[model samples]
Each structure stands twice: as structure tokens, then as C-alpha cells.
Target chain A: MRAVALGDQTTYDAGTLTVSSAEAAALVADPALAEVRVSWASPGDSTRIVKVLDAVEPRTKGPGGGGIFPGFVGPAMPQGRGTTHVLRGTAVVTAGFLPRAQEAVVDMSGPAAPLSPLGTTHNLVVEFAPAPGAAWEAVYEALRNGSLALAARLAEAALGATPDAVEELPGLPDAGDRSLPRVAAITNLQTQGTFKEIFVYGRSFGSIALPTLIDPGDLDDGAVVSGQLGHPSLKNPTWVFQNHPVVAALRARHGVDLLCAGVVLSPEPVDATNKELVSAHAARLCKAAGFDAVIVTKEGGGNADADMALKMDALEELGIPTVALYAEMAGADGTGPSIVVPPTKATAMVSTGNYDERLSLPAMERALGGDRVDVAAATALDAFELPAAVVYASLSPLGWGHLTCQEAS
Target chain B: MTTRVVHYINQFFAGLGGEDTATVPPASKAGAAGPGRKLAQLLGDDFEIVATVWCGDDHAAGPEVMDDLLALVRAAGPDVVVTGPAFTSGRYGLACARVAAAAAAEGIAAVACMHPDNPGIDEAGTAPVVASGEVARQMGPSLETLAAAVRKVAAGEPLGADDGRVGKIPRRNVTVDRTSAERAVALVLARLGGDREATEVPLPRFDQVTPAQPVTDVTTALVALVTEGALVPDANPDSLESARATRWLRYSLDGRDVLPAGEFRSVHGGFSTVWANEDPHRIVPLDAARQLEAEGAIGKLHGEYLVTAGNGTSVGNARRFGVEWAADLRRQGVQAALLTAT
Candidate 1:
């Protein structure tokens, strides 16, 4: 029996380098090379090494044509230029030696090159095949047979085990039926800075009727995706994230529990004075909206200055939980964490966007499983990385993990 | 002495229009007509019909129409005003209440005679002499009651304690506490003749019932089969329809198993089968039912879902629909039924 070694198989070939049973046995004895990728290499064929999986050569034309090839082409393969090839034969690696006297039987033949090559000397065109350990079928079988611990790890990672699992509160109690406090006033926040435009994100905005989940790490990507998705109901794609009606409804019906009333301060190199004015106006708007907690997601693509610090101080003085999202560092070192002030109460904040609502339900489900979701934390986990979870948390009864048990009760 | 009286009727009673006229408006004239003369004769020299006003019921009930009617009553300078002893006719009763309210606002004494079953009695309160009996023949007694009420006003006497003859009018001067439970107790006590100074209202304690334990996990949760399957001894028991309470039925399914979709067939006599046929999909349980079934959630269809043609359905009929549908759904182990109201 012959032993074969596996690593990245894109560089290997099957036509050259014929292996005897003794060499295969010797290779198989090493623990590190347990997962073998068999390839054919033609002896002394240095110029052309056919990689079994390289059915199609990379196209050099058009945008995004050159890069690492995408894996997995099921039934619906996209139309493109590429060579079609079939597998030649299975090269088995074993732990026993066969003397030169015995002939080897090979099954599975094809016109293509070996899937992956081990060395990079030749422009090896390797056809792709799953390594022994990396095959999905093998993994699935292992899982079914209880040979894999991945399932347990996944179950552990899920939010099902929390002591007081967060659950969605039943549909908001009927306003007419429940004893609700009459809303005296609804204030619309307008940004007064020279920047004039502040991009906001939240639920019920954008083109998609449903919100996309966002984890903190994916905030930038989430924003881009949300903007690109654009709400089907909106006329202007950019303005979709700035839905004031949703804010008004949230304030009127759900009260401060569901929204964060705040403003964004664009970083310097834009307009320093305008940022201060916008910050002041935001504070006033918060008071008007009857919100005492404000979250400020600092605008990207600018340097953080004293203005950012001033805005934060002003918000803090208003006696509200003030959080700054994506705050760049001040000074020469350029190092500082994004600012966050943990809310002491179940404070409701009104947001134009910043937080996505689609992920609220799932996040709430996870929260119910005992995850402490910090709404104020604009960390990667809380904003864009796991946006769906963020959205779920936002829509949960506890108001996007900002709610404590006492408030929920 | 001939005491001047103004009679106000709506467009319908004045023969000017129908339901369309009910929404038209209030118009006035110098002297009494039709029923106004009948009222004058009943008063018999003691009262004279000085003016008559006919308005659409909708107008008379509206703010602008009421304002116009009040101006007319003031201009007529009638010693008193008399509106319909509106029978069980709801529109007529509503019109009568509006006119009476306008007259009272102008400080002109007014009386509305209505049957005990007339909804106007409840609406107009005790200010109008809401006759306890039927409308047609009770005119004689209604007139006598109106004449006496007018005489009391002319004699400078505060209107006497309500005799159940007239319905009660809401008095702005009466200061009652606004808390519902406290108000309920006070109202009950006042009816019992408890003196306001000595009244001690006892508040009722409301104990919150604990909610049932939620299903532990969606995947492993046991779906209890609540269908009237082989679990019961009798196939069809004689159950009293009115005595049933709404219940929640739970069902569980292993991963990815589709449950049977529950069928909803309207069986109540209140609904019109005509509309149901025109748009069968409107009544069909498709969207909501299919979604629930696909999610492995409980599939429940309340027996005998009530359907009614909203068009031209009287308030009485609508109320009856609500009551009957609620009762039917309650009996079928339904916690809540998806009601599609047109």
C-alpha cells in the first residue's frame, strides 16, 4: 500500500512521480499527513503539471476576473469560459508495502490532471477533490456517528442556555385597552451642521421591507449593504434609512423603550463649528422627543478632534447615556476605544437609523437565551458583524438587549 | 296664556329625504308643522307652536348644524321646545336628542317623548321627558308631562328630581371622580341613596393570574393533540354552545414535518353566503393558516366561523354578529380567531 500526503493540492500533479507501495506506506505512517491528497505527476514533465480540479483556467478579462477561484459548483454553474475535464482515477494511500512483483489495480478514470499538486515548480493545473479529512460527506458521517464534537460546540455557542432567556414581548399591548400615558409632544430632530446630511440606519427603513442583521464588527459593511439594499417603498435610496415616521410611531406607541433619540457629529476636515451646532441641536431634539439617552455614531472618513469630545461632554451633561460609534483616536498615537456610556435605566432612544431592526427578533431570541446584549456598545459584535442578531435583539421585548430584567418584568 | 313652542324634526321625519337626508342638514321655518301641531293641540291653549325646524339628522347631530339649530331656537323665542317622542327608531331618536340638547343649551325648556326602548332615552339622558311607554298613543301623557315641565320653568322652579320620565342630561357642573373603579363604586352607591358625605367606596383587589409555563424549546416541545380524536368516549357529545370557554391547543412536530392545515367553514346563520361566493378567496384560510402549518405551529380552526355581509347591516345586526361569533369561537377551543371584517 502506498501513502500520499496532503496540503494545498492546487500545486500537485498526478502524471509524474509514480509511487510504490513502500513509499505510500512510509508517507501514511506520519500523523501530520493523515489527510492525503492524491495527485498524478508525469516523470520529468517540468513544464506542464495538470491540477485535477483546474477544470477551468482563470479568465483575465473583465472586472474581478482574477483572484482565488470560488469553490463549489452545484447544478447551476454560471456561464463562463473554462475547460471541462473529468477525473482520471483514485490514487489510494495505505500503510502497507507491496513488493514490485504485485500489480496495482486502479479504478475511476478520467482525462483530467490530478486534483492538487504539492510543489509549485510547474504551472500545475490541478483538478479539485476534497482531501480525506476535508470532505463534507466525511464530516457529515462523522457527525452522525458522534465522531465529531462540532455539534456540541455549535449548541454551546447558540443562546439557548441562558437562565432568563429573552423572549419577544407579545404584540405591544393595545393602546386603547392599556392605560397609556398621552404623548404631549413629538419633536423631529434636524441636523444643523454644515454637513447637512447625516446617514442614519435602523429598522423599517431601506429598500428591503425586512431589516438585515448587523454585528458591531460589520457596521461599515452593514451600512453599505443596507444602503445598497434600499427600501422598495422609498423614492430616494439614501433617505430610506432616515425614516422619521417610524421614529414618530415608535415614540408615540412604544415610547422611549424602543428608540434612542440622538444625532451624529461628522468628524473634522468637514466643518468643526457645524458639528458642534449639530450636537447641540441633537440634545435639544432629544429633550423634545422626551428622550434622556442619546447615542452618537461619529461620522467616518474624518479625523476625531476636540469637537467630538465636546459633543460627548454636552450629551453627558444632559444626563443621558451618550455613546459614540466608530470614534477615531485623537493625538499622534491614534489609539482609543470607541466611547460608550452604559445606560443605568431602561432608557429608550430614538434613532433615525444607526441600529437595524431586521435582526432585532433573532437578537432578542439570543438575548432570551441569557446573552447580555449591550445596545450602547458599538463594538463589532453589536453593530454590523452579526447584524441579524443585532436586529433581533433590537426588536426583542427588552429593547435590543439594552433592557434589564427588572425593566422587562 | 299661549306659551310659544318650537318643534324640531330631521330631514327624514320632515319627508325631505331618507338615509341620504339623514346626512343633509338642519333647516327652519316660522311656525309648527305636522307633529308640531299635534303637540300644540295636546298642550291645548297652554302652549302654541310658534316655529318649526327641519334638518338632516346628520346635520343636527354635527357641530355646525347644532349651532344653526340653536340660533333658530333663540330667534323663535319659544317658551319651550318639543322634539319627537322618537320610537324605537334609532335615527329619529338621535335627531330628537340633538334638537333637545340645542334647545337646552339656548336656555329654552325642552321635552322629548320617546319609548323606553328608544336609544334616544339613553343618549338624551333625563332632560327630555322620555316617555316610558310606546310612542303613538302616549302622546297624551307626553304632552301633559311637557306642559307641566314648561309650567315649572315658567314658575321659576328648579327642574325637579328626575322622575324617570325624562332621560338624564350630562351636567358639566357635577364633579365626579374620574377613576373608573372608584367611579363605578360611587355610581352604585349613589343609586343606592348613599349620601355623598357619608359614602365609603371599597376598592376591589385584582389578583394577577400567573401565566402558563412557555414551551421549553421549539425543537423538543411536545405538541399536545387537542383534536377530538379517540381520546373521548363519545364521538359527539351534546355540548351547550353558550357555555364554552376559549381554550389554547398546542401541537408539536419533529423537525421539518408539515402539519395538516385546518379548514375554516362558516356555519353561522348571520352571514350572507352571497358575498362568500363572489370572492371565495376572501373567506379562504390560505395565507395565515399555511404559514402557521409550515412553521410546525399549532393548526387551529374554530368551528362555525361567523361571516356577515357588512353592506346595509344594521348596528343591531352587527352587534349580534359580534356576540354570536365570539360565542361560537369560544366553544371550539379557540384562543383567538382571525376575524376578517370587510
Candidate 2:
């Protein structure tokens, strides 16, 4: 994977692509959308973006391959084996007001500026307004389509530019050094049906029959796309899947201290019966893969916690050691138990801090996406105290960020 | 500018006789008394023992005496309050803990010293505490420990492991050098190599509740509606938080036949509330429950519904809310409840 800068230019200049707001609007024009507005937010700028839908990295597959975000932007074809051009330090952010959407705020400059990937990146935000009386399903489809289209277009500018740096991702082999621990990564994606489903190769994960195995390389090439309306702090989004930290860590240590087995995608079913079935199936696959240990992460909370608990029980019961990564719901004052479902066997875990810890966001000079803050109460986006739950990927269980919980007296 | 320190002790420590003075009321001295002299010496000229408040162990345990002792300590306007080196005396330990806890509640920095297993330690509130030996012979070392803790507390420094304090403290949010992902990997490797302490979050003990007996006859049972779905009026008149809610609210349903779609909506932030907004009954089920009431399936329906946002709610807060809700239900003579959790 090679990355280049998105330099400002009407066309591809140096490594950057400069497109006016008009040009950006033209690229993602859809009948379902009433209006499309383009804006820019760079690090250290006094900008706050509310109602954030999802953030996507700009990447494109080189000749003779499917485009970025396979299944959504292009054909759901096999990827992970060819040259891919990525736009580093850049993101295509989709923002809008959805009736049931969870709040996701990105502060360009504040105490929370460095807590989220969206805050650090040079984001090109696409704000969409639904056509009057438009069906929510159609509006959501338009949002996804428009965001992916913009991301693909930005990555296309990186083509023919001098490569800045390239990362050679490690491949999963059948077996490795027996002396080293063999480990795999299993994550549950939000599968609460339409509008809250995570798409794998352009398909809803909820529709998948069983736990599925996919290459780490495919995950980087956009095999997973987030359409979840769950808590913003926990949802993977598209960019998180594209730059999965757990997978990166495992792959980075492959052959050194451990062997990276493979990545498994599990569904976070809402019901107890399906949750049990899915967790059992996921553990079965891990056992069949002959993994010595596994690193687990989950999407959202509540039901996801149950799914994680079931998986841990199943895996531990089979004599497989596992480490689960998750965020605690320790309330605002931080005087509460963090975990919801107490693990019966899998005791090893990593906490991504307290998602319910409130953070006071400084008043921004500029607010984008909407005028009012997206919360249960009515308030302006200029300034407010909100829980980390509303911050984009701040408490992601995948552990991409630095927020953590510590015991104190 | 020295830090003003207020020291508190029991009747015996004040040299006022042992069991005979057990009922003596709280009294105050202008300067260092008992262990305060040692604390003052150890804390040096940087900290001054502005006042010393002493009380009978038995009297201090009473609420009225606690208020009087707290008044004396507050009047001193000390920078920080230090209590005990109570050793193993149960009554003295309790008195010290209560005084420190009271002072701390008024936004004053406070620290208490006692044996680690002292029963009174439970009342120490959020103030930092130093641990002493089990008997009075360890007074010298105990005062030394309390003196150091006093310095730190006065200087606004956090008490750490080396401070000789009891553990099981509160959990705070902090940013670490490594991401959770990196930590998870490192922990997994450690555990695989036979390290049992690799778990970052130890599994907490959960509470198990005995089931309530089913009502013998629903025709005479008083049914009530309870939900964690965060259902509230459209205006959110009470302003219930969307997530991590600390309070639960009750709304009257005396005359309403159904929870209209636009009139009532879910304020929960965990799951998508779209369906609930389109039809509020999906979460609260007030409509169906009302229908059941009309069909004589139950003797009577409770006139009010209780609600709170369950999203990201801490277990402790959840338990607190449940206890209060249950108490209210019991007081209102509600026999059976249908709770809807999202």
C-alpha cells in the first residue's frame, strides 16, 4: 500500500487533488439528495462537525482490480493482491441529520482534537440534505453512495504521483514457527439489520449465515464498510476497518513473537438465541483454525457485550485463551462498574476507557453539518459538555486511540 | 504561605481518660494536640496545625455530634483536615472516618489513618486514606504515614502506590502511551507465557437476585409499566439525558389511551430510536398494556410509567435506579411490573 498527499489543485497536481465545492457536489450528485455542501476541516482549526455519519479513507486499487470499497463503490470482487494508491492525511467524511442517528462530533481543535482520527485528518466533509419526503432508506443509500464516490475520486488523484511510503502487509500462512504463539483476531460487527448493518464486500453482515474468514489485506482494501447508527465511540466506521489497529498489531508482530493466523468477521445479533449461535459458530471457526489465542473486539454496547460474553465462554470452554478489548460504561462521575456482562471464563481484557465520561468541548469558531447539536436535549453546537460516547471513535474497542481507564484513590 | 492543617482525634488520644470519657462531646483546641504535634513536626514549617478537634468515640458516632465537630473544623478554614492514626480501636476508627468524611464532603481536602481492615474505613468517603498498624504501639510510624499523606493532599498531588494507602480506590480516566489494541496484544502474549495477571480489567462480581413469586391471580394484581427505553415527552420537559442517565422520571398515564408517535419518543442513545419515534409503544408498550387492562387481564393499571435511558448506564447507577424504582413501586402498592429494557 502506497500513500500520497492530496495537494490542493483543480486537478491532480503533485500528489494533491484540488476540487472546488461545486466540483465535489457535481461528483456526488444524486436525485435522493436535495443539496450537497462541501467543506474542509484541517487539524488545529477551530471547527466542530456534528451529525457525522462516517469517515472513509481515500484509496483506489491499481489497474485490473476492483475500486475502493468493493461491493459499494464498485463490483464486489476479490481484492488484497494488487497495488493500491492511498491518500494519506486525508478523509472523506459524510455528515447529515438522521432521525435515529447517534451523535458523532469531530473537534478540529480542542482537548478532544487528538482523540479521534477524524479530528487529525484533513477532512473533506460532504453534508447532504434529503429530498423532501424522501424515504429514509433511499436517503441512507444516497449518503453511503455519495461518501464512497467522493473517496474514490480523491484517491484517483494519487495515481501517477511519486509514492511517499509503502507498507507491505504480511500475509496469513497455513502455519508458522511452532515456538511462537499462533493468534487470530475476531471482531463482531453491528448487524442490527438495515441502516445499522456492517457491509462485507457490499453485503449486509446480518445476512451472512456463519462466522466468515477474510484476509487482513482485504480489510485494508475496504472489504468492510460501516452503516451503523450505534454509539459513535464504538462503531468501526469505514476508516477504522481500513486501518484496523488490532490486525495491524498482530501482523506487525507476525513471526516475531506470534503468528498472525487470520481475521474472522462475526455478527452481533440482537436476540439471545442468535447471539448464542453466532458466538458458538465464531468460536468453532477459531478452534478449527487451530489458533492458540485470539484478540476480540465488538461493536456498540449492550447486546454486543452479550455476544462477546458468549464467544468468550465458548472459546475458553474449548481450552482456548482469549483477550477481549472493550470500553466500560462507568457513568459521568466514573463511579460505576465498567463491564455489563461479567466474563465467566475469558478474564484477560483491555479497557478502552469509560465511554460515558463527559468531556467539555470548547466553543468552536465554526460549526459544520448542522446548527444544533445532535443530542436528546436542544443545544447549539458552539459549545457543550458531552460524554465520550458522542466523540467519533474515541473509545473504539479496536484500540486505535490512547484513551484508557486507570484506578485511582 | 503554609498549608493550614486541622487535626482530629478521639477522647483517649486527647489524654482525656479512656472509657470514662467515651461520652464526652466534641471539643476544639487552638493548636497541635496529640499526634498533631508529630504531624506538624514532620510536615515542617510548610504546614501549620491550625486547630485540633477531639471528641468522644461514642458521641462522635452520633449525627448531632458529627455536625458539631464538622462545624469546628470548617470554622478553622484549614487547607486540609487529617484524622486519626486510630490504630485498632474500632470506635476511634469510626469517629475518625466520620470526621474526615464530613470535612471532605464540604470540598475540603481530608485524609484519615487507621488499620487497613478497620470497619470504619467504609465511611471515609472519597478522601484519600493512609493505613496504620493494628495496635496503638505503631503510633509513631502511623503518624509518619499520615504526615506524608497530608503533605501530598495539601499540595493537590494524587496518592500513589508508594504512599502506604489502602487500595480498592476509584477508577479514573487517563490517556496511556499505548493504544488498547497494542495493550491487548501485549497482554495476550504475556498470558500465553503463563502470566495470570495479564488481564487489564478483572471480571467484577455480579449480583444475583432471587426471583419474585408470580402473582397468583392477575385479575386482582396491580400491574405497572417500567422501561429503560428513555421514553419521554417530545419536548423532553424534564431533560433526561440521552445516555449515562443518572435519574429516572415518572410520567402520568391516567387518561391517555395510547402513547402517540410524536407526543412521546425515546431519548436513548444506544440503539436506533427510529422505530420507537414512529410508534412510541414499541419501547414502552403502553398501548398493548392498556389494551390488556381493558380486557380485565389485570385488576388495575398503575397510573404512571417510569423511564430512564439505559444506554451506557453504569452498573452501579443502574442498581441505584432500580432500588429507588422498586421502592417507589412498593410504596404505591404495585404488585407486578413489566420492564422493557433496550
Candidate 3:
């Protein structure tokens, strides 16, 4: 937990992080939130978010199991090792009324906001309302405890904070370099729930039945989390399941180039008897965690790619060697048929792009939440026609980014 | 700007009058009219034919003469069109794969040649096509694989089977940017030292359908109740979207039998809607289908159900929603559909 890149008027002792309007109406005091609006945004702002209900990255629960989002609330701890600060150049997002009908947009600046990774940090923009007869499971538990009580009151200004930058990633201590290469990973979530869910510590990983495993120190802080209301650019929120860039690039290249061996998670089956009961117990927990090579990923891109091609054909029918990645709607002129069930021994694969390729942004002097652009106020004036999935928090089902490939156009 | 190709031969490679003008009709002329002057002399100085067209394998075998040779090769705008090495004339190789699939549905970047048992090589869809060689001494290696696939479709690229010397036309694999953990650690160091790779998704053909013809005795069937899972009501009053949905909702079990939870829910985000939003028939079951239609074992049901959230949907939009929900349940007569999915 380090994430410290705060600048442009952000403060964690390093000064300045206000939000006015009676402190955003007393920071989500939850009467199941009758109204809330917050706002902050930084890093090249012409502002232009819309309906995007989730975009986290504000982290702050210092010291192990401090539980900010571990399994979604209160006590379910088990995060990967100790301490956590990460306001890593900020982000909160949330966006107008939403308990489920998903969102992710992030254009903060123009030219497609540097292709959105929440347009390079520093953002807050919440906007909420629910209470006039609440109950959408209490408006999704008051927008998930009012967006984790506003990222723990802006991580209470990083109290005595330290981090300025640090991302080591640990996890090895043992396998004592048996010539590296054990590498594991699985993932394929989207427990198929009311909102393509996943939450694990705070419960509801579709009431789990098997393929679980996950212990890279309970993903180092948030024992797994996400609203990931599928397809808003291939959803995996909860700050990309607590910063999972392939599990922090396998804990920053674990025992060196391989020996990582940590995740499995699974779920995403939905028939063929729960895809042979979770790809044969995740290919027998990747050969009882001995693993020679695995890496799966995938979450929401039609038929969860037949549950990651049934755990890459049950780990290549046992000869091990797998690797999947996944995504791809590929239609909308990307020439359709990107993939649906696959796994006839999934030969390598990566993809993560073309979830209907389309985008047309330009105008924006600022507009978040209740976004107005009913089209034509622009065309002759500024130009708007946006929303064609090029990062409404999308298509990166964790294979991070960069996709081009229409055979490299 | 040089590239305007458009060739498409026939009528004895446009010298006309073969088999009594093979039934005449379709036409077009200006520029490279015969064998398109050897594909504009092997596309030297980069492609210029401009127009050739010629019809008549018995007048392009009907469909009103293939819409008059696709309106004279789409009025020859041509950035690439090409059409015929049609060698083993199975009706001029299915009329040069239907004028290179009607100049690729009008976006125009066709290719087509012929012979791989030419029934127009399975009606040339991804458009590439080349193979040629059952007659006329393989017309100079099928016009040099149609001048290197019309120079990779005039530089816009995307002709498939990845350059195995251009015999392509299978396409739809596309998704290759490396990092399936760097191809699973280079396929586990080439399969733990044995070797053999290539699997980037090539194993799905599932698409089955055949079911119908069952309800013979379900108490005089009419059945109905479908789902892609987005149940409805409960404020979803057509708000729908529970995941790449593409609108389907239908609701109304009219005089109802169950599904009540503050009046229905589960707008499907794939699953776990609190046991179908607290027993909304655990997924539109309509109370075990009205308790098997009050034990008559079933006979009525069809009171508007349908739905549609198959999560990230799209297996070609779930086969165009099973061909528009089997043509709107065969125009609402239904007969049987139970269908339910999480």
C-alpha cells in the first residue's frame, strides 16, 4: 500500500482536498443518502464524465486488514500483507443515481482523455440520491456504505502519512528459486449475479461452490472486491479489483521471472454443470498449486468465454501450460466473431479490446453526473457524440491496455 | 489516385459470345475489359483497371441477374474489387463468388478467385478468396494470388489466414496482442521442452438448435415463458439493462400466478439476484409454471414473458436473439419455450 502521487491541489497533510457544500452534506451520513454531490477532479480537466457510477483508486486503510473494502465492509480482513495508503494521485467517481444500471466513462480532458485510466488520476465527482423510498437493497447498501464512507474521509488526510512512492510487491520468501517458472493465476470471475458481481470477503461471490483459492495476501488489502457491472469498458471496478495489473504483474515479477502462484477465484461457469464444477476445481487448483504456467483472467465478454475455456481445457487436459486473458465483442465493424466458448485447448490468446469499437468525443467545458449532451447542442458548436466503449472504464479485463490488433490494423 | 481496381470477368472473359453469350444481360465496359488486361498487367504501377464487370453465367444465375451484377460493380468506384480467376467454371465460379460478395456489401474491398472445389469456396464471406486451379493452367498462379490480395486490399489490410501466401477466407479469430502471461511463459518454455504451440481460440462451433416438436401431451401445450434474464417490473419498468442486454423485456403474466416481490426483479447481471430477487420464481418460473398450470401439467402460460440479458450477450447477439426469439415465438402461437437461464 503505497500509491502516493498527489499533486494539483490534493491534500493528505501535503495540504488541500476540500469539497464544500456542507462538506458534501456531512460526508455520506447515510439516511440511505437522500442526496450528495461532491466534486474535485484534476489532471487536465475539461470534464465530461457521465453516468459512470464507479471508478475508485483513492485507497487508504493503513496497516494490514484495516478493512476499507476487504470483502466489502466492516470485518472480513485478510488483505495482502501490511499497511495501505494509496491515494495514488486520486479518484473516487461514483456518478449520479445508480444502484446497478452500471457506468464508467472518464473523459476529464479531451483527445479521449489520454485514453482513460480514469484520465490520469485526481478525481472525486460522486453525485448520488436515494432514500425517497430507498430499498434497492437499500440503494445498494447506500451506494456501498456511501462509497466506503467517501474513501474513509479522504483517508482522513493521510494521517501522518509517509509514502511518496513505493510499489515493491513482495511474496516469495520460499520457493527458493527452483529455477523459477511455477506461475499460476486463474481469475475468470463475474459470479453471474444481479450485477455480474464478485465481493468475497464481504460475501456474495455467487454463494461460492468451489474454485476459490485466492491468497496473494487476500489481494494485498481488499480481499477481492468489485461492482464491475460488466461492459462499461469491460468492468472490474473496486479500483480494478484492488490494483490487479495481473496481480501486480505477478507481485512485481515474483521470484524473479515466474514462481508467482497465487490466484484461482473461478466462478463464471453458468452450466455444463457449472462448467464441470469450476473447470475441474480450477484444473485441480492448477495442479495442486505446483503450476508450471497458468494465467487466465477473463470476466464478462460473452459467455465468460465458456468459463475461460473451461480453465483452458482443464489445464491443457493436465499437461499444464495454459494462458488466456480474454474480452472481445469484436462486432461493430471489427468484423464480428471474436470468440465465445473457445478452449479446444485455448492456444495462448490475449485480446481485451473491441467491445464494439466506437467513440466520438470532443466538447466539454465540464459535465459530470447528470450529464446533459442531448446531442445537437454540439455538432455545429463543439462536437459530442461519445459513448462507443473506448474506455468508459473498459475492455481492460485486467490485461491492462494496448490492443490495436485487427491484425494490427 | 491509382488504385481503383474493379475487374469481375465472364462472358468468356468479356470477349463475349461463349456458349451463345451464356445468356447475356449484365454489362459494364470502360478500361481493362478482358482478363482485366492481366490484372492491369499484374497490378504494375499499382492497379488501374477502373471497370470491367461483364455478366452471364446464364445471366449470373438469377436473383434478377445478381442484381444486374451488383449494379455494375457498384458503379465502379472500386478501391479493390478483383473477382475471377474463376477457373473451374462452376457457373463462372459461382459468378466470381457473387461479384466478390457484391463488392463486400458495398464497403468494397473484395478479392475472390476460385477453384478450391469452387461452389464459390463456400460463398466467400470474409471476402479474401484465392485458391484457383482446376482449369486454364491456374491462370498465372491465380493472378498471383489476385495481385497479392489486391495489395492487401489496397493497403487497408485485414485479409486473413495470416499470409500463408493468400489462400484465405476463414477469419474471425482476431485477438492477438501477446501477454496471456507472455503466452503462458512462452508456452511453459515450449511445453516443458517438448514444443508445439498455437491455440489462440480455435475450437468453438457449438451452435445447435433442433429442439421443437415435443409438447404432444402437456395437457394441450402452448407453453411460452422465455428468458435471457432481466425479469422486469420493480422499477425496471423497461429500464432493462442488467448487462449488454439490447432490450427484450415483456413481463405480464396477466392475472398472474407468482413472481411478486414488490412485483418482480432480477434484471440479470448474469446471476445471484438474491435467489431470483427472493423467489421471483427462481428465474421467471412463474411459480413452477403456475404449479404446472394447476396440475393439468400445462396448457396455457404464454402471457408475455420473453426477457433478454444473457450477460455480455453477443454470440452474434445471441444468434440475433435466437432469430428474434424464434420469430417472436412463431408469431405468438408459441407451442413451447420454457427456456430459462442465469
For DockQ, the strongest prediction is 2
Residue-level lDDT tens digits of model 3 in B97-143: 66776678777888787765544444454566766677867688778
Query: Which ranges in model 1 have alpha carbons more than 4 Å from their true place?
Result: A1-409, B12-24, B122-126, B135-140, B156-164, B169-342
Kindly list the interface RMSD, in angstroms, of each predicted candidate in the order they appear.
Answer: 29.4, 2.3, 11.9
Computed on C-alphas against the true complex, the DockQ of each candidate is: 0.00, 0.42, 0.09
Name the best candidate (by TM-score).
2
lDDT of 1 at B4: 80
The digit string of per-residue lDDT tens for model 2 on A88-174 reads: 888889887886677788899989988898888888888888898898878888888778877887777667677778888777776
Candidate 2 docking class = acceptable
lDDT of 1 by residue, B1-342 (tens): 777888877666566766644555566777767566656666677767788877765444333456777777778888877787566554566557667756766566776666655544444423455463465456566656655665665454555446335433221111122321122222222322423232111111111234445644443332222221111111212221110111212222224222222222222112223344333334543345545645766443332323333321222223223333433333333454445532
Model 1 Cα lDDT, one tens digit per residue, A1-409: 0112333221113222222323323322322233322233221222122101111111111233221111111111222232211111212111111111011111111111110111111211122222445543332222111201111111122222222232221222333432332221111111222111222222212111111222121111112101111011111111112122222233333342332222222222234565466445555655544543333322221222233344546555665443322211111111111112212221222111111112211111111111222222322122222221122111111111111110000
Global lDDT scores for all candidate models = 0.32, 0.81, 0.66
DockQ of 1: 0.00
Chain A vs. true chain A, TM-score per model, equals 0.24, 0.94, 0.36
